[model samples]
Target: MERLYQGIVRFRESDYQSHKDLFKELGQSQSPHTLFIGCSDSRVVPNLITQTLPGELFVIRNVANIVPPYRDTNDYVATLSAIEYAVKALNVENIVVCGHSNCGGCNALFAPEETLNAVPHVKKWLEISHGVKEKILREYPDADAQKREWMTEQMNVVQQMKNLLSYPYIKERYQEGKLSILGWYYIIETGEVFSYNKESMEFELVTDTFTP
Candidate 1:
């Protein structure tokens, strides 16, 4: 808590002062360009990785970076509401679903009943990506633990990207070429990012000349 307090003090004195004008302008309203859906992992810093500043990316972080398929229901949906607001109200042009290597949430999907029983809500939320687990198992039946981890993480990103388009607004905008969806796989320890190429059906390493 003390460390966080000191960091806040530094932010107010230094970072905030440096960006005072931008902050003041953003205080009035935010028009972010992208909606970044990513994991709640401490290591995956979306702004830091993307080199984006405040108000540039509207972010949604949750376990496994899941996006539930579009459904008309009376239930309260936090992530779904946020996505709607970003696309319809903020008019974000792009939506990026990022999944990272060695994701605990991805692993949790394969955990035993006792393991997941400890976090019932998380287990329930992860059901959104249950198809990811099934696909991985069906497609890579011979894969070992390490192979399964990366495959699950990468495939989960693709699954969420598909789920995003289930939203009517997103699908319409996408078909009209007014919007873009990107799936990314980030390697935490090595700091290498890979972008999914839908046509190639592969996760290509993001390099100097790479374009999303």
Candidate 2:
């Protein structure tokens, strides 16, 4: 808590002061260009990673960067409401679902039921990625541990992109070419990022010549 307070003090005295005019303008209204859906992992800071300024990216972080499929029921209302507002009200042009290499949520998916019994809610929440696990097993049944985990993390991002499409308004905008959905994989150890290519159905390094 002391560290957080010191960081706040630094922000108020230095970071905020340096960007006073930007902050002041943002106070009036914000028009972010992208909706960044990323993991709740402490290592993955959306603003820091993307080098985006305040009011640049409207972000929603959750376990494994999961975006539940659009449903009429209010099971995951918080996440769903944020998505609705970002798309319908804010009209963000891009939605990026980012997943990291060593995601605890992805690992928990393969843990024994007894191990996850204590965190029932977390266990339930991770069910969103069950399909990813199934797909991996069906396709890469002989893959080793490292390969499976990496694949799961990447596939989870793709799955969430599909889930975002389940929203009618999002789908409409996407079809009209007003909005784009992107899947990104961040490698924690190497500090490298890869963007999913729908055409090739593979994740290519962001620095590569491949266009999305």
Clashes of each: 0, 0
Q: Which candidate number maximizes lDDT?
A: 1
Per-residue alpha-carbon lDDT of candidate 1 for residues 114-204, written as tens digits (9 for 90 to 100): 9999999999999988999999999999999999999999989999999998999999999999999999999999999999999999999
Runs in model 1 lying further than 4 Å from the true structure: none
Considering summed lDDT, which 10 consecutive residues are worst modelled in model 1?
123-132
lDDT of each: 0.95, 0.93
The candidate that wins on TM-score is: 1
> At residue 90, what lDDT does model 2 achieve?
97
Per-residue lDDT of model 2, residues 1-212, tens digit only: 99999999999999999999999999989999999999999999999889999999999999999998888984648899999999999999999999999999998889999988999989999998899989999999999999999999999999999999899999999999999999999998899999999988999998757567
